[model samples]
Target: MADQHRPGTLGHYVPYLLGRHLRAGAWPPEIGKRAILVLLGLLAVVYGLGFGHMLGNHDLSATLRANFLLGLYGTVFTSTLLVDFVPSYRPVQRLLPDHFPVSGRRSAELAFLLDLISLRRLLLGVFLAALACVPGQQRVALLGVALLLGATALSFGLRWLLTWGRGRRHPLVAAYAAVLALAGAWLTLAATKSLTGPLAAGLPWLVALLPLGLLAGQVAGLGPQFLNRNLVRPALDTAESQWLARLSPEWKAYLRKTWPALSMGLAFKVFLLVASSVMQAKHGSDSSRSIFYLVFLPVISFTYANNNLYGYLYSLTLNELQRLGLTSRLLVLYLRLAVPVLLLDCLLSAVLLVALFPASTWPLLGLLPLSAGVFLALGLWGSLSKAKPVYKNLDLMNMRNNASTLMNILTLATAATLYFMPWWWVRAGLAVSIMLTAVVPVRRLLSNHGPQRRQLHHRLQSM
Candidate 1:
């Protein structure tokens, strides 16, 4: 009875002859959506209270203000990127507006609403802004937040204004990009320079106000053509088919957007390496142990990128399609790709760590084969035991993922075992034992994989 009253996802579509404009607003599906947001907001407040001391460590007014503004800008900037880019990457999302016939202005409005809701990073910004509130900062943390928001608004308005012009958007895009690049470069240099120079300067706050006039202007909304990527062309749609011949049918099939994950997997390792380096000064080599132990994933990074490489997502092809396929061929196919890439990641990460801490990292070299093997085997099992649909491009928000909490826990256990064991030999032995756990799953997959094939294919058409 309650559901009947709600209008959801274009309950009313006007025909060309009847109504003048189409109604495109989408409401939250259920009351729980708003309830969850309320709970999250409350949780963020509690979290902020807990992290207050770390933020406010430096009591100087200038230091605190600079740090707060920096955190806010970083949060909004990064979160904005995710909101703007993630939706466009989703295969379904790209085609939705195209088919749905939502006007560009309506699409932009919806995007803005989603962007506002997805700005959960504002919570973290507030938490870090506590840095400026410890009684010594020259500028108020609250005021700094306001300034950043204003700058953000002004930038957006200007971006829309510049791009809304006729003809070539390329030149306009280039000019916009150049301005942002210059601004970013200057800010980066200033932050890295002596603290008293830019960190304590009042100039940054004043500079944030540069867009005040633009903020007052009424900017017209642009269409999704301005926001999203050009449509994914069919294989033979263009002359680019020259390169298509070079790739095998299988590669052409799933080349299934795996490189993005692989590239991201490497990026994940790089980030961990940087984090470990920062923590190494304080916690020693213990911090970087993740680089060695968690070979399945360097971070939670690739979990969404698809835990199972290759046909794991497209098991529909190997299993149900093409007169039913063998699991071994699929298994071999998956491992064939996953093996070298992950091991290389592990090796490169180890080598870099070794260069940093030669004596401590030598164990990483010894543990490399065992640790990498164990996770690779586990990844094989993980990829098969549960199935998820394939997508053209990976997005930050995707429902069709095979990753589970248990897998992450098991990966972490590898770190814990290596961490507690003083003897490097014992650690390698444990990894070998861990590798054995994949045997049962491998046997099951070899014998009876029909259910998994079905699972992978389930609702795949919707994606």
Candidate 2:
């Protein structure tokens, strides 16, 4: 009976040990070395400045201190909110079953532990530790930093646990909603000056610990239970065929046939729009909002141009079209494809502006034509340039690369114009510049590289 009980005891501890091993493997070797160097460098700098002397001379006003704390807390909250939705860092659950010959419950326990030791937590810890040495009310500043880090970690852990409990349902949607609510509450508290002195001092330490305790409880017991249940169920596949198939009827049918490329383009646009809106709503001041609008307009326009270029290039399978004796048919097909994409750009820009900033409707109405012209030029150029055309079919990776490059160039140009001129006229000029740059070279390249035909008589004589 004692020997039989031993196996059950060992099984309970298996997840904890496996989690530690997995974390050790996941962390990059360079990160540990760099973290050590950074910590040492920070210590040396603080000591050289005479930490006590610097604190004595610190001129941080009450307002400055309050703002710094607010910013720090806001950053932590945002990071916690985004952690679960981070596409690249998602846990490798599929790999777990192969590596660990254990029950799903044990496997999940290990995954939870691995997540606790994630790079995100380590970086947040480093940032908080560095803040402790900053010149301020030493005890208050240190305490504040500690509270912020603890709260952030707790929030992150809780979010992950909830996600697992929900069978990993759209965590990002919930996270975004939570973040918005928190931001609203913080603003209200700040405006009322209720977030000061006693309330601030007492709340940080206590409130921070609550989440930590909750996180520990969830991880220790509930985590394995949720994981085992979730693992037994069939995984949810997000891949939708009907939506992708609908795109085939559109003018960009040739390109849309490559479902992956279409999906990626749509996903990227949605992500950018959502992220920008969330940031603007949470952090935008009067001055910052103005700056944001100025920056955002050009950035969105550049993105529109890049997407147009991608669609155009994807539709034009130059090598394949060259073999078919149907020059007129191919040209007609290209024109049909270009028209709808150009129109879509115009529509998307109008809708996005209205959705994000309804007050900017008049400005957007004026910007639409300019945007349309720029998109047309980009699309036409992309179609004309036989350079790296998607011959067999659309390749998502290549499309991404091409789109990124085009967007980067356009964005840089917009930036330069804004720096030198910084006016509506300058923005309009930038739009015109993008059109000229794309149109002229592309036209010339296409004319030169147009499909060549060999006479049948000459081919027969050579044979």
**Residue-wise C-alpha lDDT for candidate 2, range 1-463, written one tens digit per residue:** 5563342133545556656664563343567645654675566445434533444454957675565556556556555444544322243342253334444444544555555554444555555555455665466446545555454545455455444545345444354345356555754586456887776666556545555555455545554454433434333435545545455443344443344443444454555555566655766523234333333333433343333343334333334344653244444555566556445545654676568754733463565566556655554554343223233333321333334455445554544444345377866887788778864544443444333222211221221
Q: Please name the candidate that would achieve the greatest TM-score relative to the true structure.
A: 1
Task: Give a tens-digit lDDT track for model 1, residues 124-230.
Answer: 44443644545543244554554555445444544444434341253444544553564465467555654355444554554454444333323242343533444
Using Cα atoms with residue i matched to residue i, what is each candidate's TM-score against the true structure? 0.66, 0.57
TM-score, cand. 2 vs. native: 0.57
* Model 2 deviation from the true structure expressed as Cα RMSD, one decimal place: 9.2
> What CA RMSD would you report for each candidate?
7.9, 9.2
lDDT score of residue 119 within candidate 2: 46
Runs of candidate 1 with Cα error greater than 4 angstroms are 1-40, 51-73, 86-114, 119-175, 190-203, 206-245, 253-260, 278-302, 309-312, 315-322, 354-362, 390-393, 399-401, 445-463
- The lDDT of each candidate is 0.50, 0.48
